[model samples]
Target: MPHSLSWGARSIFKNRYEFKVRICYLVGEGRDLNFWTDPWHPDGPVDSQTSIGTMLSNIPRNVSVHDIRSDSDWKEVLNSGPYGELTQIVHSGLFTKELPSYPLVPWYSSLWFPGHLPRHCPVVWQAIQSRLSTKDRLFFLGSQRDSTCSLCRSEPETHHHLFLACSYSSWVWRFILLRFGYRRKPNNGLQKEEEWLRKTFKGKGQIARAIRIAFSATVSHLWKERNRRVFEEKSTHKQQTLKDILDIIKFKTLYLKLQDIPSEKNIRISNILGLPCFSKEKSSRHCTWDPPPEDMAKLNSDASLANDQGSIGGLIRGSTSNIMVMFSWNKAPETISELELEAILEGVKLARSMDIRKLWIETDSMNALQIITGKCNCPWRKKVTLKLLQDLLTSFEMWKVSHQWREANQPADYLSKHDCPLKGIKILPTTA
Candidate 1:
């Protein structure tokens, strides 16, 4: 009755398909329906076990038939039912069809697919539709009289003319070709350039990636250059635009290479950020003092002032003694706190040059000492100065920074006043 209605019906249909089948039964006024007859024999009907020989004949080879009354009970039939093997076969076929052909993906697609493609593909499709529907011959051409190419006045404004066909574009293309050692002439049509790109990158791995990155960056830059000239009333430079493309290519290539090596992440990030390559030059513009020595006996000094242009003072002393180098100056700040910072930097430079190891530095500028020790807020001008101080700390064997009263740093203070006029160097008299 009703084509052997029961949970077994689920084996013949699922979800919406099962719902539609149930609707068909209602539409047929609950009449007995035979699905396994000639018309529907391919799909077959639910099994009945009235005759053992008939049931055995109805079951397909290598299949087992079972009865399931509920969704949960279907598991038992699914695991060992007449259709279990068929289900497995269907699943395997579906999976095989869905598997991606990883190797066949294009070079540019591989490079930009992860992030850019998820966003760009839909956008490109939309643009293609809009461009096709527009009345203008050139996809982006405007109707205004002034909307003509600056170099080729005969053509409407378009991406192809501004980047490939126009005189300015030819000059830029030639510059890029010469710089990169390519001898080909600029393609006059955008389609030709696309074809050239496809041919040029044909089986080359590294070259293809470079070309794709260069092409995309060039497209973006050319559009920007065009807008700048039209809207901002600016002139575009062919060499500069070509240089931008080359720079982008070099940067992306290096970045992708770095991404492949997990251990070089930090180094690559530093390079991207324009950090100085690590070295042992022993002197940099940022350091305020030289590193200490292995002997545990050295002198260090730092000068600082409340007002950079007001007065600068510093003291240099041996790690274990009272006497060393000291100086102070009254030069006014060029900006805000430049004079005070320069004084401290000069003291550090002296220590570095003298090869001072294990030096004790004293400064009357509490704020400067706090910044050096990382115990206080740093003024904006002191950012570079603070970084240099940190770099210097890594170079020395031992170093100490201390705060002292301005009265206690009299000798260096006197030396600064005396040196201000003559701009002369003076050695501190030994108090011992």
Candidate 2:
């Protein structure tokens, strides 16, 4: 129906375009997803119900994915024998927790660099990318009255002007720099200041780290003050802002002192690894074991080599500080470190099933700790061990695997010298 009555004639495609992508229907009103037809199970489709060796029928062809509600409803839809067990197998898949399903920002690595504050990094990262919701950005996105700078009102509010050229921000920077015994006025614009500060902190020693911290803190707080004025209709004095800048730098600097930054201006291009320790000590330290918290369990593990055979041993202790379980796994001849990792893997698997909510795993092998913690990268090491440990840590509510000196882990050491052990977690009651 052409209301304008202006078109004489037109020709279009005779057929519609076709696509073959499967739509993953999110489970909703329970009316759309077909129970048998849709491939909703994590493993595979449950068509015919015979896939899992179940002999069954009479399920409505249009039954929903979430058809089971109560025990009676489940019994009604799923037969008590073969079909019941099949449904039970796939039910867990229907409600499995999904991982994050969002696009990640590219500035992620830049946000978590050494000396960056966890709380302020995202905000600063946004500002660095000029993606912050500054007045100009808001106005461009259809915010009418927010187009102008509130403090100066001289120019359209932009990231550069708000953070760099604004007289109020400049004054705050000058005041803070003077307090730091810096009589000079820093670069006046955001890009210039950012570049200069990056170059300035490219030198060696404590002064460079201190200067970088102050610069980042100042930028973060000045933006905070600007945001407060814009949204909350309030303004803190320049001196107060200066004090805040110093306090934040001091607090965040306590936990972030990793000098991973490269000074060659080819910064962060490559991950520089520290040289591994090759020196062997003649005498070991005499250290005693320490127990974990009462509600937690501690797992100590060791791997030893004897007569061209690798033996892995570990022990788990309950909150009462008594041994809960001990295990030894016979492995083919491998490096001592690899065997140590296998022992730890066994210990972690044991702890998860022990009814304890928290676990503190200890290993005398520093190489194992370093690899697990991501402090050192070793391609020659076992990647499966690393992946398993990472997954276990995330699944458990609380767990920590750290390096313990050989002196502190005597039980695991003694067990590693044993002859043979089946590959499993030993289930035993409290014993002497």
Candidate 3:
């Protein structure tokens, strides 16, 4: 809203609400997010979902997510009116489900994949939609006097000619394809070129990614060059433009985790871009459960989510590998990592109640392990629970946490997927 703000900035500010509804916020530390108006919850804004009139009346409208983190904080609000409903949603978890998805479009992956350059998308998307303000489109609308192509003045400047068929753009496209080791000529029209791209780059491999990036970059630069000639009356040699496209592809490839595909063409492209291809080892190593030390008890925990409901399970085994105790509990809808952490927390509590002092914890969720070991940032909603878990770990005489592959953690995984009551923890007998 500043006077110095550009028109585009002001326009974005004006439509901020439209953007807000479409996006979800992670209530990390709750410092920045507004509790009432923000779509931090999966269901949408808190103000729109429930009646918070009498209960939240005394609370400030501008209360932040951080303000309601504690039980004591919510206690006052929950006592009065419909605010109690909000607590049920809050304690469950905050995760974004995809807003209603659109029908699968063939060009979606080509335009918007991991590591795609953002600046190239808008231009390429316009080209794909045949909506670019090329000379033909402007002439048809009576806004431009000439329908001639800006890049190659001899041809009509339609989407097909401007993007693909024109001599200038065709040369740039051919150069890019040649550099990527494709010796064939490009299809003439935009429609045919799109079909070819769809059939060719419909893969998750490194070469497909590179080709897609190069295609978009090529289209974007060609359009920019056309605009420069039409408006600014400036021109760059097609070789320089081709070099710019190559540089763009190489720069994008730098951030990608390229894999060694062991193909001659892939190698040639890799060598051209200076991309390092890693040979991932595919070992057929066996995995099995290992018993704990004579004095230590090992706990394996797992979680499952289905139909918007979550369940957690854990197994505690003594040094002899005998199941000391096993538990299955249904919980409010939560992410797998949160459920795994909860299962570990509950298992530790169970062990503590049994007077077990030495404990070893194992879970299949590396994310939970990272958060527990301070290797990653803990979500705002998990801070208090994690603090309690840390306190519990300190109470043990000797404790350790480690990650186990899902294959080796099948017992806990089974317990998590086991049918159990919706309310309380189901403690199963060791024999059963």
Q: Identify the candidate with maximal lDDT.
A: 3
Ranking by lDDT: 3, 2, 1
lDDT of 1 by residue, 149-194 (tens): 6544576655556556677767766665544446777765655565
lDDT of each: 0.49, 0.66, 0.81
2 versus 3: better lDDT goes to: 3
Models ranked on TM-score: 3, 2, 1
Candidate with the larger TM-score of 1 and 2: 2
Error of 1 at 170 (Å): 2.2
CA displacement after TM-score superposition, residue 3 of candidate 2 (Å) = 48
Model 3 spans with C-alpha error above 4 angstroms: 1-6, 13-101, 277-432
Per-residue CA lDDT of model 3 for 328-392, tens digit only, reads 98988888888888999999999998899999999889999999999998888778889989999
The candidate that wins on TM-score is 3
After best superposition, candidate 1 residue 142: deviation in angstroms?
Answer: 7.8
- The regions of model 2 sitting more than 4 angstroms off are 1-110, 177-188, 203-205, 254-432
lDDT of 2 by residue, 1-432 (tens): 445443442111222111111334344433566667665543345673364524434566677666754432344545465455432333434332123368875434334556656677666767777787888877777875658786676888888887857877777777655554456565456656766666655643333554565666777887788778877999888778877776665565444433432333222111111112222235556777888888888999999987898888889987677888888778887888788888888888887777667889899999888877788874465787778878877777788888888877888998887777556346476445
Q: Could you tell me the C-alpha RMSD of candidate 2 in Å?
A: 19.1
lDDT of 1: 0.49
lDDT of 2: 0.66
Ten consecutive residues with minimal summed lDDT in candidate 1? 91-100
Candidate 3 or 1, higher lDDT:
3
